[model samples]
Structure formats: structure tokens, C-alpha cells
Target: QQPVQSPQAVILREGEDAVINCSSSKALYSVHWYRQKHGEAPVFLMILLKGGEQKGHEKISASFNEKKQQSSLYLTASQLSYSGTYFCGTEMAGSARQLTFGSGTQLTVLP
Candidate 1:
């Protein structure tokens, strides 16, 4: 099943911080984060695997909890360039290994 993200939309000012969450009903094998700007394809952000290490880029970071089957994206000191729609793609065990993305989280960063 596709994971569900909370706070469908987020409006932030420059230098602000925001967190987006994703949860699944089944056990997760991996969680992938991506961001897509208008008129562009989604760009890979990072991926978290069960019992694997977490990763971060710039001021963005993410964590995945295998026990809870949940993941969270943390954007710190947000910038105007960070404005985009974020998606979380999840992989579940015993599945086809296909990734199913959450609806999306619309994030707008204002100056």
C-alpha cells in the first residue's frame, strides 16, 4: 500500500523549518524521498532502509523507523529555492519491489 503523508501542504518563510511525515500500514523495506519543482521531474533526495543508516544533504535530512513503518523529512533553515512538492516512495517486503509514492506534500517557501 502507498504511504500516507501528513500536513498535505506547508507554507514557510526563508530560514524557517518544517517537517513532513509519511506512514504505512505494512512493514517497510525502504523509504525514498524526492522533490519535484514545477514543470520538472522528481529529483531523488535520499533513501532510508530498514536497519540502515540515515542520510542528509545540505539542511535536509530524513529518518525511517522500521518498527513504526514511518519516515520523516526534516527541512532546516528553509530557503526559497526549497519550494517544491515532496513525495515519499515506499517499498514493502513480499511485494514486487515496486515503489509506491505518497500523494505529496506541497511546500512553498517565501522570502
Candidate 2:
């Protein structure tokens, strides 16, 4: 099953930081995080594997909770460029590479 993200929408000012969490009930093969601006396809951020691996792009960092089957994406020092929707997709164990996705968390950055 896809993980659920908290705080469906977060209102933030410039320089603020927020956390988006994705959690699943089933065992996960990997967790992938993506960000999408309105009306566009999601942009991949990072992937976390079972071996305690982490990846990032720009200022975004994500972590995988192997024991809990969860992942969290951290957005630091918010920017106007950071405004968008964030989604976490989970790859099921013994399943194909394609991920089952969570309903996205909408993020808004305010000046």
C-alpha cells in the first residue's frame, strides 16, 4: 500500500522549514520522493533503499526508516521556488520497480 503523508497543506514563509512524512503498513523495497509544481509532472528528488542509503538533490534531503517502512522529506530554508506538491512513492517488496504513490501533500510558500 502507498504511504500516507501528513499535513495535507502547509503554509510557510520564506526561510521557514517543514517536514513531510510518508508511512506504509507493508514492507517496502524502496522509497522515492518527488516534487511537482502545479500543472506539471513530478520531479524526482531522491531514493532510499533498504541498505541505509540516502540521496538528495539541491537542498532537499530524505531518509528511509527501514524498520518502520517509512520515509521523510526535509525542506530547509524555504524558498519561493519550493512552492509545490510533494509525493512519496513506495516500491513493494517482491514487486515491480514501479511505485504505488501516496496522495500528495500540497505545500505553499508565502512571501
Name the candidate that leads on lDDT: 1
Show the colliding residue pairs in model 1. none
lDDT of 1: 0.93
Q: 1-111, model 1: which lDDT tens digit per residue?
A: 778998799999999999999999988889999999999999999999998457799999999888888899999999999999999999988778899999999999999
Candidate that scores best on TM-score: 1
Every candidate's lDDT: 0.93, 0.87
The residue-by-residue lDDT of candidate 2 on 22-110, one tens digit each, is 99998998988889998899998888997657666667788888888878898989999889999999998899688989998999999
TM-score of each: 0.95, 0.93
Q: Per-residue lDDT for 91 in model 2?
A: 91
Window of ten residues with lowest summed lDDT in model 2 = 50-59
Error of 2 at 6 (Å): 1.2
